[model samples]
Target: MSAKRVDSTIVVVAVAAAIVGAVALLGVLGQAWMGYAPSHLLTYLPMILLPIAFALVAVALVRAALRRRQTEVGQS
Candidate 1:
């Protein structure tokens, strides 16, 4: 991939990550507002999802960075 393509992919991934994070946060808040009682299983649902989402985002960002580096090196 070219530098331009890599940069665009990074931007798109970042935007997607932000959207997913927002939706996950909203879901957690909504559940709380609905008076759902905290339990061993119920309490950790949001926390679990949040980390998984973040990890996925991190992976995408790293992949983009690596691709950009590879393209740059290849052009030299």
Candidate 2:
């Protein structure tokens, strides 16, 4: 992959991870609606996932910005 290239898949995966994390947390809190309590491990899954997801998204944003900047610079 080129230094200035940003992968849309990476961005999409990060967003999905974040959403899954948020949903997991909600599921844990809303166990009553779920009809069963989630295991502790499942409850902790979101805590472990959210930061990684956010970090990936941050990296994607920075890469996309760099790529855009390079494109603009090359055009000038």
Candidate 3:
């Protein structure tokens, strides 16, 4: 896919990751403070999301930098 599309996709994923992180945080806090039990999925989500998000963001940054460099080279 094109860089623009990739960037947009990353934005969407970032939003999703943020939402999931919030839910996970709520799960933890709810269990600790309110004596509410959280599902296993909610507890384990951050462990899955954080690394994936980090990798995606790293790749996107590298791709963007490469695209920018190519454009600069073409301009000159």
Candidate 4:
């Protein structure tokens, strides 16, 4: 729908990804330190999610900046 809505959703997703990634990283650590074996998906989730989170945040920021510029130009 709206740019604001898209931005909000992107931010929410980014936060979720980061949280999940952190949890997965902890699982990985537990596996290494305490011999708690995680599944293949869990073991690799941090690698996937952390980068996605970073990219999503960057996209959200750029989208926000572009939207702001568009609004400013429209008002001028």
Candidate 5:
């Protein structure tokens, strides 16, 4: 996939989805803690990708932030 170009818009969507999925998973986990049905947790299993997606977005963001900071430091 790196051999071809990917759209920036898609990456943004993935990052958004990743964040929502992670929050939903956390909510489901909270429900389990409150003595809700164990089956409810099963529904959230598919959200595991959120953490991975979140990590990807996080890395990219961190890199960008550091680069910007480095530029500012160099200029000053």
Candidate 6:
């Protein structure tokens, strides 16, 4: 488990989670807008999860970027 492998896994998982969250959110919102009550659950669940998912993705990206910068500096 090298640092690079761990980081790559994190990034992949975060991105996939974020995408799933976004899709769920959109589906719920769309259904609700069309006057479906059951979609409320979908809307709320994804609304909560979406932000967390996005935050995870953002953190992963920032970490990767910082690591790249550090490596570049070390090489120079």
| TM-score (C-alpha) between model 6 and the true structure | 0.67
Local error of candidate 2 at 14, Å? 0.7
Per-residue lDDT over 39-65 for candidate 4, one digit per residue giving the tens place of the 0 to 100 score? 798888999999999999999989988
Query: Relative to the unseen true structure, what is the C-alpha lDDT of residue 61 in candidate 5, on a scale of 0 to 100?
Result: 69
C-alpha TM-scores of all predictions: 0.50, 0.71, 0.73, 0.83, 0.45, 0.67
**lDDT tens string, model 2, 10-75?**
777788989999988888878857788787966887998899898998888888788787676454
| Per-residue alpha-carbon lDDT of candidate 5 for residues 7-72, written as tens digits (9 for 90 to 100) | 354467667777677767777777789998645444565356676676767766676677677665
Q: TM-score for model 3?
A: 0.73
Cα-based RMSD of candidate 1 = 5.7
lDDT of 1 by residue, 1-76 (tens): 9866766765676566556656666766767799874454444554665566577668667877787777665544
Select the stronger candidate by TM-score from 1 and 2. Answer: 2
Inter-residue clash pairs, candidate 2 = none
**Number of the candidate with higher TM-score, 3 or 6:** 3
1-76 in candidate 6: lDDT tens per residue?
A: 9987887887777777778778887887787788886466676767777677778778878988888877755543
Which is the leading candidate under lDDT? 4
User: How much is 12 displaced in model 4, in angstroms?
Assistant: 0.6
Q: Give the TM-score of candidate 4.
A: 0.83
Report the Cα lDDT for candidate 5: 0.63
Q: Model 2 misses residue 12 by how many Å?
A: 1.7
Error of 6 at 29 (Å): 1.8
Query: Ranking under TM-score, best-scoring first?
Result: 4, 3, 2, 6, 1, 5
Query: CA shift at 33, candidate 3, in angstroms?
Result: 2.0
Between candidates 1 and 6, the one scoring higher on TM-score is 6
| Candidate 1 backbone clash number | 0
Clash totals in order: 0, 0, 0, 0, 0, 0
lDDT of 3 by residue, 1-76 (tens): 9769979899679778867877786787788687777777878887788667777788778888888877765544
Candidate 1 to truth, TM = 0.50
